[model samples]
Target chain A: MIAILSGGVGAARFALGMRQIIDPTEISIISNVGDDEVLHGLHISPDIDTVTYTLGNAINPDTGWGLKNETWHAMDALTDYGGITWFRLGDRDLATHLFRTQLLSEGKTLTQVTDRIRKRWKVQPRILPVTDDELRTVLYSVIDGRAQQLTFQEYFVRYAHKPAVSRVIYEHSAEARMTPSVIQALENAEAIVIAPSNPILSIGPILAVPGVSEILSRRRERVVAISPIVAGQAVKGPAAKLMAELGLRQSAYGVAEYYKDIISAIVIDDTDAGLADQIRLLGIKTFPTNTLMTSPETSKNLASAALSMISGEPV
Target chain B: MIAILSGGVGAARFALGMRQIIDPTEISIISNVGDDEVLHGLHISPDIDTVTYTLGNAINPDTGWGLKNETWHAMDALTDYGGITWFRLGDRDLATHLFRTQLLSEGKTLTQVTDRIRKRWKVQPRILPVTDDELRTVLYSVIDGRAQQLTFQEYFVRYAHKPAVSRVIYEHSAEARMTPSVIQALENAEAIVIAPSNPILSIGPILAVPGVSEILSRRRERVVAISPIVAGQAVKGPAAKLMAELGLRQSAYGVAEYYKDIISAIVIDDTDAGLADQIRLLGIKTFPTNTLMTSPETSKNLASAALSMISGEPV
Candidate 1:
């Protein structure tokens, strides 16, 4: 079994690429859950839905999120009622939340709901939430010159992640235990691949789970990470800005340092060749290649490289 | 002031005609609530939405319900999750339910939500539900040689109102009180009109509220009703089938008898002009004209005749 740690768009895209190189049936994706929130009384898990939609070939290629040919009729009507429309819920996407909310209210766990959704999408990989319990990412941002804590959506959607964030913390991560399937997937994996997602915002919360980081630390030799921040900038989203604001290195070297304790090798872009020595000095192997996944071939090649790196194949 | 005791489609269409003769702002429609039901955890008041959408010019003319140019993406997706898709919910229409559900959860009454929704639609008619409390229409039907009780939607939508209904009852009608607006609108009205909706299915529930029938009975001289039946046939819906099943008068004369106690006059169609003298024998005046609202002119003419009948104008 091949286990993958994933977030939203980047993670989903990477998994799509990885599918090109391996049997999707052999993959178990442990998706981030810190971005989950209840909107309009409907339970929404952004990461899980993104991965599920992406793998099922239902994702909107334009936005890299939501469903293809989706309509925003509900949202357009919502604006007339003075409802918050920042998060951008599409017409078709509302079904996932409605089904999930109904099932969860009927005493089904989030895990069961996720399974039902994936089954409907016919997604091949086993998509497991990091935890079924409540765990959220809260950011302390300076708004109107006063530091106030905001939920992940508020920071990311409402404020457009423009406000200066003083700190980022995970809520309930300390007490939340990883799901049994996730633990088993980790234990039985031939290799664990960390997807090229936002290291701090996306991947950080997964590591904060009580036993997740420890498990990866123990199996460090088989853990490989693809750096999202390449050439000091993220290919998409706010990784570089967030890292710079959080007072961390904004280069591939910074990404390697973030996962150094729990990873055997770090894949940097060809542009980040100058940072190889620095990452190597931190006691982690570096794989330099054309990591910019502009096409399916690149992403699949990246997946092949991860596999080769795990099997001790020559670079 | 003109007060209309209303239900769905027929009532909304009647109100549209009435608007052609009078200022919409001067009209107050007290709608039936016995058909209201919760589906997918969303509070849906079909009658209220119909009247609201109709007056706002946003209604689908072909279907006689829902918004114009609406998308069914949410509902189509819902079918994949094994949800009940028989009660079609369009994408834009889901916003109304979502807003209503959220506002109701936040302690806003159904009246408040209705006002908010109408205001957004820019509807001028003061559409008020008969009561804010829980009230539903339940039908007893014989299916597969067994007597079964079903909600109004099940009888109307799921079964296409096909099952032989033995009886119809209203839930919580005795305990439910009319909203303050409805009571005040009724007490101060110059004329009260029972729209040409399904009398047993629509107008029956409105009058079923504990004090509503008594209030109108006391003001019997000022009240007028339009017959849904004309020449032993209903203009639309299951009214004809239901009236026949319930063993009520299946003609305009029968309609006159149904409202004989509280209404001063009943408007029948030109086709049913032969039954006027027989209706007058029941101590009610009969206004026979072209009541087939096939065009805006016919609906407007019917509305004008109803107004003239109230004022002793030449019929």
Candidate 2:
């Protein structure tokens, strides 16, 4: 079995590429559920849904989130009712939330509902959330010199992540237990690939869960991370800015340092070839290649390169 | 001000007609909520939604319940997830449920959610549910020689009302308090018109509420009921069968008897003119006219005739 540690967009793209080369059923993905939040009485796991939609070929290509050909009628109606419409949930996407909420209300665990939904959508890969427990990423920001914590969605969607970050806390991580599927995937994996996702906001919370980082550390020889940052810029999201805010250099070398003890190797973009030597100096092997996945072909190339590096093959 | 006792299709048609002649804001409709049920954790008030959609011109002209041009993506997805899909909730209708469910979860009363949703749909008429509290219509039926009480939707939609109904009970009528808006409409109305709706399934449950019948009886002079049954047959639904099963004659005279003490006048179809004299003997004036509202013009004509009759004008 091939296991992948995934966040959102970049991770979903890499998984889709990997699915093309192998039997989708042979691949297992441990998705980040740290960004999960209860919004408007609905449980929304942003990363989990992104990976599910991407793998199922149901994602809106233009927006990279939500369902294809989604309607905004519900959101329009919500706005008319004086509801906060900052987090735009398309009508079709709302259906997913409604279904999930119903299942949750009926006492189904998040993992069970996710499995059922993915199976219904015909997604063959076993996409398990890192845990079924609550592990919210709380952002502590200084607004007018008063430190307050906000849910990840409130900081990211409501404020567009514009607030000055003072600290980031992963609430409930100490109590969260890795799900059986997650542990099983790790125990049986032939190779483990970490997708090019936001290191701090996405991957950081995943590693924070007790036993998850320890599991990766014990299996370090088989684990490889594809760097989200190239040179001094992030491929997407606020990864680079977040790295600098958290007192880390905003470069591929910073990414290598972040995963040094947990992963065996780091994949860097060819544009950051100079940093590959520096990344290797951190006691991790480095594979420098064109890692920017601009299209399906580029995504496949990246996935193939990561897999080859894990098998001791030169890409 | 006009107070309309509404059910669903026929009542919606009459309300549509009345809207053309009166300021919609001046109209108050006390809709039957006996049909409401918690389906998949959604509080779906069908009769209220039908009336609201009809008044807003968003109702499906063909199906007569949901919004026009509605997609069934939610229902389709629900079935794909192994959820019960016997009752069809269109995608647009699902939005209504989602908003209402969220509001209810946030501790808002049903009346508050109804007002918010109706206003958003741009429905001007005050569409008040008969009660904010639970008042479900349970249909007791004999299927395969066994008696069982089914929820209104189970009887109406799932079984298609196939089994012979033995008893119809309005559970919670003893506990349900008439909403303030409904009481105000009854007290302030210049004329009260009971739409041509099923006497047992629709109007029966409204009168079953603790103090509603007493209020209507006190205001009998202004209260009028248009017969749902005409010429020993119902225009739609199981009214005829239910009336027969209840050991009442399936005619307009039976409707007059059903509303004997609370109504001052009964409007009977011209086809049922033979029952006019019989109905008049029940201490209620009878007006014979064409009550079948097949078209908007016919509906408008029926509304005018009923209003003129209640106003003591020649019909």
Candidate 3:
């Protein structure tokens, strides 16, 4: 089985490409639930849904989120009914939320509902949330010199991530217990791949869950990570800004350093060829390739490159 | 103050007409909630929404349900996801459900949420549900001689009410308490006008609520019911078939007999003029006019006619 540590768009795209190249059922995605939040009483799992929709070919390609050809009727009506429409939910997307909310209200755990929804979407990959417990990624922003933590969505969506970040905190990371399926995937995997996702917002919170980093550290030889930063810029999201804010060099080398202790190899973009030797000096093997997945074919190439590296083959 | 017992299209149109002639704030609409159901986990109150949309002039004039110029992207995507899509929830309609579901999850009562929603729509009428409790109207039918109790939507929307209903049961009627506002409206109303809605499925369930009929009975002199049946047939729904199944004449006189104990006046269609004297024999005054409300103006005229009858004036 192939285990993938995912964030959102980038990882989801890579996973989708991997499904095209490999038997979809052979893949198991351990998605970050840290971005989960209750929006208008529905459990909104950004990473999980992104991965599910991307793999199922249901994602809105233009937005890189939500369902394809989505209608904003619900959001329009919601606005008319005095509801907050900043975080827009498409009608079809609302159905997923509605089903999830109902299932959760009926006492089903997040894992159970996720499985049911995935089944309904006919997704082949065994998508598992890192944990069922509440694990919120809180952004501590300094607005006018007053520090306050905001929910991930509030900072990302409501404020458009314009808030100056002082620090980021994962509220339930310390208390969350990893699901047995996730632990088993990590333990039994022949190879582990971390997709080119936002390291701070996406991958950071996933690793913050107590046992996750420890497990990767123990299985370093099987773990490989693809750099999200290509030519000193993030493919998507606030990864670069967040890395610079956290006092780190905004380069592929910075990403290598971040995962050095837990990964056997780092896949950087061919554009950053000079940094390959420097990254190799950290005792992690370096694979240089076109890591910018601008299309489905490129995404598959990236996944294949990472898989080959994990199998002790040069790509 | 005027109180209207409403159902769907015809009732919504009638209510809209009344709003045009009366100070909307002086009118209270006690809508039928028996058609409410949890679809894909979202609580859908169809009758309540129809009334709200019609009064706010947002209802689709073509279908007489949902929002005007609404898209079906959500339903289309839902069908793609292999979800049930027989009960078409337009994109804008989905928004109402999403907002309502969110508010309900946050512990807001249906009444409070409805008020907030109406305020957003800028509707002037006090739209109140018959009760806050669960009151489902189930139609008992036999397919090949096997009995089953189908939900109101299942019978109405899914089957289009083709199967002959052997009986009708107002589930939770015994336990339902009249909404305080509805009871107050009944107690203090200068006039109570029952819209020309399906008498069995619409007004029947409303009166079945424990204290509602009792209140109407006590103030019978102030209550007036417009006949859904005209020329021996119902304007809409299974009222005619249901009446026949229940062993009653499918005529305006049948409606007068159905509501005779709790109503002082019966308004019939001009086509049913011959039944006026026969309906009056049931101890209720009869007013024959063009009760078929085809447009907003007609709805207002019908409302005025009912109001006039209650005031001891010719309509």
Give the TM-score of each candidate: 0.85, 0.86, 0.85
Q: After superposition, how far is residue A274 of candidate 1 from its true place, in Å?
A: 5.5
DockQ, per model, reads 0.50, 0.28, 0.38
> For model 3, how does the per-residue alpha-carbon lDDT over A212-311 read when each residue is reduced to its tens digit?
9999999898899999998989878788888888887899999999898899898999998889889999888988999988888998898888888877
Displacement of the residue A111 alpha carbon in candidate 1, Å:
3.8
Kindly report the interface RMSD of candidate 2, rounded to 1 decimal: 2.5
lDDT of each: 0.87, 0.85, 0.86
RMSD of each: 4.2, 4.0, 4.1
> If both were scored by lDDT, which would come out higher, candidate 2 or candidate 3?
3
> Where is the poorest 10-residue window by lDDT in model 2 chain A?
A306-315
DockQ, candidate no. 3? 0.38
- Ranked by DockQ from best down, the candidates are 1, 3, 2
True lDDT of residue A196, candidate 2: 94
Residues B128-233, candidate 1, lDDT per residue (tens digit)?
9899888889999998888898888888888988887778999888899999999988888888899998888899899889889898998777788999987798
Candidate 3 per-residue lDDT over residues B60-146, each given as its tens digit: 988888889888877776675555688998887787887887788888878877888788788899989898888999999986678
Clashing pairs in 2: none
Q: List the residue pairs that clash in candidate 1.
A: none
Better by DockQ, candidate 3 or 1: 1
Best by TM-score: 2
TM-score of chain A of each: 0.97, 0.96, 0.96
